[model samples]
Target chain A: MLPDPQAGGQTGSLEHIALLRPLSAEQRAAVARQCRWRRFASDEQIIDHWADTQDVAFIVEGRVRVLSHSAGGREISFTDIDAGELVGEMSALDGRPRSASVVALGEGALLAFLPARPFRDLVSGHPELGLAVMLRLCDKLRGATDRIMDLSTLGANNRVHAELLRLARRGRRQGAAAIIAPIPVHSDIAARVSTTRETVARVMSDLTRDGLLQRRADALVVCDLQELERLVAEVRGAP
Target chain B: MLPDPQAGGQTGSLEHIALLRPLSAEQRAAVARQCRWRRFASDEQIIDHWADTQDVAFIVEGRVRVLSHSAGGREISFTDIDAGELVGEMSALDGRPRSASVVALGEGALLAFLPARPFRDLVSGHPELGLAVMLRLCDKLRGATDRIMDLSTLGANNRVHAELLRLARRGRRQGAAAIIAPIPVHSDIAARVSTTRETVARVMSDLTRDGLLQRRADALVVCDLQELERLVAEVRGAP
Candidate 1:
């Protein structure tokens, strides 16, 4: 069962997000009037696979992760969302049952929930609004395509290294090293790289022993990004 | 290397394709003026991954299959599209290079190509055109999500059954059996199900021996879809 969204505290406004920032004040106000602001605690589902109804959720604060769970309670994650990103629009656009569940990732998250009908009215009438959604969808499609390619073609070790390199690009950089905060658990890494937890543990241990990776209390640090990149590219015939 | 698009015949007119059907005759004329008609032979790539530029392609006739290839000659197919579908819009939407290559599936295919700028101009300015594209994009997103789920969660046997059920939905139906024409090769099945050619051949032989499937000269027939569905569902924890 999913936890209920707990609402409180300051949140990012519609005027500030990347997609909505392009809208004029008047347009922003119009959208704001129709949207319902809600907050959810970490690990709480914003959308569930079994749910028939869905709203377009725009992330206002914190992060959200999209994933699907197996019957055994194991999950496979697809993507993560930060503030200024949107969630649940795939179901809103296609009118299908939510194919996956989205959960609040850290601490808690704030979202502006726009019901489908009004959301469609706004997007169809405003070219910028529609383009904003399309642009984001395109990004998701490209990411999905890359994931499919990597999962199908690469060996498990290469996949893990490749995924780490990808996460490093999005993570915080300190000097020459990249840090992924709250170092993902074995299962999370397993899910992302499409390997088992044992395999991930083995690969991670090897990397740590080789000094290519270092796990601090709360983060996984890549000591040398170049070496990590080289590891990921080796199987693809890269020199 | 990719084969060139072959040109000839009376293709589906721009006005007849689903996306352009709602355009006014004048609007259609404007679009038609900017559109180019082309056809591609079987296995010919409509859009190559190496290309830097892209145009929105509307399928007027025949089918196109989308897939990504690794440097070592392995590939993973994502989806197949038929007439009334559009392709290459992802690159147009995000201004990225084509991430996947699309190839004509059957004998040949006809398409109406609209260069990126003009296509965007029409879609952004016109709600119907924009919505049409959005709907298609949404469909692709959902399909991608499903593929991700199946690839990540299901075992090889379950994945094979799941893929067959999916193909059966799109293939021709006769009595109790679902027929997939031009019966996909073992390698193709392996690619789709994320297994090896030997594994797919082994699974096929088993299914045929069990009387749940039959092999025709140019098609694979599922003789017992219920049993196949049962097989797929049991692993998925379906009731």
Candidate 2:
């Protein structure tokens, strides 16, 4: 499901957007006037895979997950975008069908949409924005590469460990460990690493049994971050 | 093994490069004068995973395979870049280590190299080049997304079939059959699909037995493209 192109919110300023930050206030205001804005509630669909519309959207508030469904109704999550980030540029730049669907996470999201032509013009007109776009794409490409390596070379258990390691790295660091507050949902992890929820549960239990993980109310603490890294490194091998 | 950045090739022009194609002749000449050129023999390494250099290289002739090795020395092929494509931009644009190793394929390769600064300047100064780079990255991202879906959902046999279908689509069509000249190397396909060579061999044999594929002295002919597509679609579910 996708929100209607013209139905949701009104246009907003581009002042807070990371990609447009390098532009001057006057420039930002000029660009913002040409865009439309919308608000979506939690679990709302923002864009559908293969949908024909090709407007680029900036996530001005809230987080969104990018994903697609296989013919079997299995969902494969790609990557999530936070506020100040953007999506739909793939279709905007290449004039191809949407690569994946996008859905709002947590609270509802506020997004500013720029039609493909204007989006292209803005990027081309601003070198800073152009470089920013390239850098963002590079970051995504690298993340995708690592995921490919994991899927191609690692097993389900190892993938779950790797995903946990990734989550831990992004979590808040404690004295000698990392605390992932509000532990991630098992099914979500399963979707990300392409495994079953049961497998994720099994791996979590194993890690707990080995004293590498500790589960507490509202948080999953890595009791020994180094040990967890070592486990992942052993499977990934030398790189 | 990675080639020394300063050890290979001399400087060359930006003329005939796809990313630079939109530039005028003068612009191409001006940009070309700032680049270095080199020739890599078959099987020669162009760049290594985690390499430190950040110069962007353009393939002027021949093809190269992008891949990485696991700790156990297993090779995972990412994608192949034919003439007119570029590589090393991940590092060049992001100022990070190379994400994967690249090696020349077939007879050899002729490439033009542009130092990171000039490459960035050329792209940022020219909107067309910037858009071209974006489009190229979009293509890579889309391809990687497809591979991710395949790796996450498809089994080895189906992955092999999907890989074949991909190759067949790129191959010569002969009425009802698609002929892939010189046939692909099973091991290479195995590397691409994250499966064992033995498994690829077994799948190929099964496909031949089922009369879906025909092996010849110089090519592998897919008997029915639609049937192969149907087989892949059946496993991928309804997308």
List fnat per candidate, in order.
0.62, 0.84
For each candidate, give the TM-score of chain B: 0.86, 0.93
DockQ of each: 0.57, 0.76
- In model 2, what lDDT does residue B223 have? 97
lDDT of 2 by residue, A44-94 (tens): 999988678899988888899999887777788998899888998988888
Q: Whose DockQ is greatest here?
A: 2
The whole-model C-alpha lDDT of candidate 2 against the native structure comes to 0.87
lDDT of 2 by residue, B143-233 (tens): 8898999999889999999999999999999998999987899999999998889999999999999999999999999999999999998
Cα lDDT for residue A47, model 2? 94
Alpha-carbon TM-score of each model against the true structure: 0.89, 0.94
Model 1 chain A: lowest-lDDT 10 consecutive positions: A1-10
Highest TM-score model number:
2
lDDT of candidate model 1 versus the reference: 0.79
How is the predicted docking of candidate 2 categorized under the CAPRI scheme? Answer: medium
Question: Any runs in candidate 1 off by more than 4 Å, and if so which?
Answer: A1-13, A172-176, A217-219, A236-239, B1-12, B172-175, B217-219
